[model samples]
Target: MSNVTGSFQLMKSLNRSLVLNKIRSAGAVSRAAIAKETKLTPPTVTNIVNELIESNLVRESEMGTSKGGRKPVLLTINDQEFFIIGLDVGARKIRGVLTDLNAKELVADHAALYQDISADQLTERMTQMIEDLIQSAGVERTQVVGVGVGMHGIVDHEQGVARFAPTYHLKEIPIKEQLETAVKLPVFVENDAKAMALGELWFGAGRGCDNLIAVNIGVGIGAGIIFNNRLYHGHNAVAGELGHTIIDINGSPCSCGSFGCLQTVAGGDSIAERAARELASGRESLLREKIAGKDEINGEIVYECALAGDQLCIDILQETGRYLGVGMTNVINLMNPAKLIIGGGVSKAGDFILGPLQDVVSQRALTDEVKQTNISTAELQEHATVIGAVTIVLADLFTPDLLNAK
Candidate 1:
C-alpha cells in the first residue's frame, strides 16, 4: 500500500513539474497547448496546473489568439516571485549570484580566497557570501527555494562533497550539508564545469544541442560534457578532468605532480608563466613596460599586452591555443560532441586564442566532417559559471526526474 501511494504521489509531482516546465519554456503557453504537447489529458493538466497556480509557480497570462470560439488563457512561470542563490567557488575568488526562478540576476557578490585558507574558512566565506546576497536582495529567506554551488576540482555531486580540490589542497568538504544547514534550504553542489555546461544547455549556446562539451580554461582547465541532453559523469565522477590529460610527456610540472599535463601548458596561470618566462629571457615586448616582475604578472596582463599588438603576448596566447587544440582534438575524436564551447578567464583572449585553436582542429581532426565541428566561445562569459549554479536549483524545481519516484 505504501509503495503504491508513493508511486502515485511521485507521478503527481512529475505531472505538475511537466506542466510547469512547458509553460516556462514556452514563455507563455495555453493549458490546451501543454496537454497537447505533453500528451497528458486535459483533466490531468488542469489539476496539476491548479496545484502550481496555488503554489504561485504558474500564473495565467494574456489570452492566446482565438482559434474558433472563446480565446484560450495562456500561462507563464512566476519568474520573479521566487529566487535562487548560486555560488561559484574558484581558486582565488568566491563569486555568487541571486537569481529569480527564470535565472535572471537580481544581486551579485564576490569575495577573495586566500591561498593558505582552510576548508572551514572557505565554507565560512561561502556562507557569508550567501547571507550577503539574501540581505542585498532584501528577499525573504522562504522566497528562495534553494542554493546552488559551482565548485572547481573533483566533486562528489551526489554526496555534495568536494572530494579533492587540487588548487586548494583540500578534500572531503561537505558543502551541501553545511550550506543547507546554514540557510535552511536545499543545497546542490557540482563541479564548476559540469554546472556551466548545464547552464549553457539551459540558457546559453547549448540550448538546442544534445551532445556538447563546455570547457572552462581558467586557473585550471576542466570540461563539462552533455551526452544526448543529459550530463555525463564518468564511472568515477571525474569525467571532464581535461586539464590533467597528459599532452606532453616531457613538459612542465603541474600542480597534480604530473609532467606535461595540458593545464601546465594552456591554463590561465600557465599563460602568465609563459609570458613571465619570455620577459625573463629579456624578450623585447610591451609586457616589459607594463609590469615590474613575474610576481606581478597574470593572464589578464598578458591579454592586455596582446590586445596592444604585442607579438610576444600574441605568440604566448596562440601557443596556449595550440596546446589546448591538441587536448580538444583528443576529446573530439573520443566523444564526437556536436559542439565545443570555450569558457573561463583564459577564453577572454577571443581570436588570439580561438583562431589558432580552430586552426589546429581544422588541420588535425580525423575527417572532413569532424574537422567541421563547431567550436565557439561561451555566451555568458564572466557570468557563465555563476548562472550555471543558478540553473542547478532551477533544474531541480522545474525538471521532472523520474528517479525522484525511486
Candidate 2:
C-alpha cells in the first residue's frame, strides 16, 4: 500500500473510533454535539459518522426542531448494529447469550451436562455454540467484538489460564488461548462471580454505586467485589473467595478440605442435602409432595417449594438466610461497600431469601455499618454474569488505542 494511502486510512480509523467513543460517553447525540465534545472539526465528525453509518455502527434518528434554521440530525449507537457473545460456565450447565451494544439479549442457548466434560471437548462445543448464536442472531463475523467466558474457579486473566475448577474437574487450562484459536476471535476468561459483579455494577442493581459487593449463591457461594469504582480481583484472582471463609472451626467439612466454611452450610449442595434428609424423615410439607418419588433434590426444587410457601421450605430458606446473613455481616465489616447485591439461581426465592438475610445482618453487623449499607437482589437474575463477560470484551475492544488503530 502507498504510504499516503496508509496515512489516510489511519486517520480515518482514528476519527471513526473517536466518534464512536463520543456517542458511547454521551449517549444519543447529534453530530454537532460529538464534534464539540471531541474537539474535532465538524467535517471530520460528519465524515466519520457517515462511515459508521455505512458500517451499521451508528444510525441517524429524527432531527430535533430548530429554533431558527434546519434541525440537526440526531445520532445514536446502533445497539443492534453489532453484537458480542458471552458464556457462563456453571457446574450444571453452559449458558450462552448474544447481546447488542446495549446488552439487550438477541438470542440465548444453554446446554446441560450430566457429568463434567474435558477441557478440549468443552471448548469445541462452546465454539460451535457461539457459531450457532451468531447465525441465530444474524450477525456478521466482523460485527462481534469477541467472546468472554465466566468460569467458576481461579482464573489468571493475564495468562488466560483457569487454575482449577473443582466443579468441572479442570486444572491449569489455557482457556482463553484455546478458545480464541478455535473461534478466531479475542476471548476473555474471568471468575463467574466477578463477572456477575461487573454486570451488576454496569447495568443492574449496582448501577451508579461505586463501592458494591455481589454474592453469588449457587452450587457454591462466591463473591464479586467492586472497590474504588474498579473490579478488585486481588493478587491471584482469588480475592472474592467468600465461601471459603472459615465460619466454624469444627463445622461440616468443605470441598476445600476446611471445617465450618460458609460453603459447608450455605451452598446449594448443602441445602439440597439438608432438604433430602428432612424429607426422608417424613417432614410434613409440600417438599415431600414435590419430591415424592425422587431420590434426589436440587436447589431449584427447593426454591420452587419455598416460593410456593411450603412451611418446611420457608424454614429451610430462613435458616439458610440466617447463616448467609452472618457471613454478609462479616462482609460488611470487611468491605464496607455502599451496597450489597445477592445473585444466582438461589436468589430466585427473592425476599424469601433476602428478608431473613437482612434480619441477621441487622443483628450481627455493626449497628453503624448496617445503617449505612443496603442489600438488594440482583436485577439481572441469572444473566448478570454472562452479560458482565460481554462487558469485559467491549471495554477491551473499544479502548482508545484499539478502536482508533487502523
Candidate 3:
C-alpha cells in the first residue's frame, strides 16, 4: 500500500511539472488549454494550477473569450515574485544584471579591467558588483534566489572551478566557491559561450530549435553547442572550444600557444590588430582620421569605419569573415545544427561580415543540405550571456527535483 502511494505521488509531481511548463510556454493560458497541451485530465490541471497559485508562482489573470460557453479564466506566471542575478565576467569587463524570473533585466552594472587582475581581486570586485546591482534595483536580498556567472575559460561546471582562462592568465581558481561564500547565495558558473547558447535556447533566437550552435566572436572565439534540446557538455566539459580549431598549420600564432588557429584570423582582437598594423605601416584609410590614436583602433571602430565605406576596414572584415567561414564549415560538417547564431561585438558588422561568411560556407561544407543551415546574428546581442546566466537559475527552478519539492 505504501509503495502504491509513492508511485501515485511521483506521477502527480510529474503531472504538475508538465502543466506548469505548458502554462509557462504559453505565457497566458486557460486551464483547458493547459490540459490539452499536457494531455492531462482537466481535474489534474486544475489541482496543479491551484497549488501553483497558492504558492504565488502563478496567478489568475483576465477572463478568456468564450467559444460559445462561459469564459475561462487565464493564468500567468508570477514573474515578479522572484529574482535572479546574472554575471558576465569577460577579459575586459565584468557585467552584472538583476532580472526577474522571466529573464527581463531590472537593473545592470559593469566595471572595466583594462589590465590583468588577480583572482582574489576579481572575486572581490564581482562580489561588490552584485551587492551594488541588488541595491540599485532596490530588490530585497531574500527575493534574489540564485546567482549565475559566465566567464571566459574552460570552466568545470560540476566543480565550480575555472581550469584555465588564457585571456586572464589564471588557472584552477574556485570562482564559484568564493562568490557563493561572499554573497551568501547559490552560485552557478559556466563558460561565457555556453551561457550565451543557453540564453538563446531559452529566450532568444534558438527558442524553438533543438539543434543549435551559438558562436561568440569577441577578443576571442568560442561556441555553445545544443543537441537534442539540451546543452552538450562533452565528457570533459570542453566540447565547444571551436575557436582553437587549427585551420592553418603554419599561420599566425594564437594566444592559446597554437599556430594558425582560427581565432588568430577571425577574432575581434586579431581583426583590430591587423588593421592597426596596416595603419602603422603607412596605409591610408578613413580609420586614420576617425581615431584619436593608434590604441583607439579596436573592433568596434573598425566595424564603424567599414560601415562608412572605409576600404581597409572592409577588406579586413571580409578576410576575417572568410576565415570564419572556414571554421564554421568544419562545425557544420561535424554537428549539422539547425541554426548557427553568430554573436558578440563582431557580429554587429552585419552583412559586411555575414555576406562573405555565407559565401564561404556554401563552397566548403559537405552537402547542399548541410550548407542550408540557417545562420544569423544573435537576437540578444550584448545581453545574451547575462540573460543566459539568469536562465541557469531558471533551469534549476524548472528541474523535476525542484518542481517536485515545490
Query: Model 3 misses residue 366 by how many Å?
Result: 1.6
Local lDDT at 101 for model 3:
81
Clashing pairs in 2: none
lDDT of 2: 0.80
Which model, 2 or 3, shows the larger lDDT?
3
| Candidate 1 deviant stretches above 4 angstroms | 1-12, 293-295, 400-406
lDDT of 1 by residue, 191-251 (tens): 9998899888888988889899999999999999988777888887889999999998898
Distance from true location, Cα of 87 in model 2, Å: 0.7
Model 2, residue 162: distance off in Å is 1.7
Q: Which residue pairs collide in model 3, if any?
A: none
Clashing residue pairs for model 1: none
Worst 10 residues of 3 by lDDT: 1-10
Model 3, runs deviating above 4 Å: 1-17, 30-51, 65-73, 291-296, 399-406
| Candidates' C-alpha lDDT | 0.86, 0.80, 0.84
> Candidate 2, which segments miss by more than 4 Å at Cα?
1-21, 30-56, 59-65, 280-282, 398-406
Looking at model 2, residue 120 earns an lDDT score of: 82
lDDT of 2 by residue, 155-193 (tens): 776677889887877798888888877776678888889
The alpha-carbon RMSD values of the candidates against the true structure, listed in the order shown, are: 3.8, 4.7, 5.3
TM-score of each model, paired residue for residue? 0.94, 0.86, 0.89
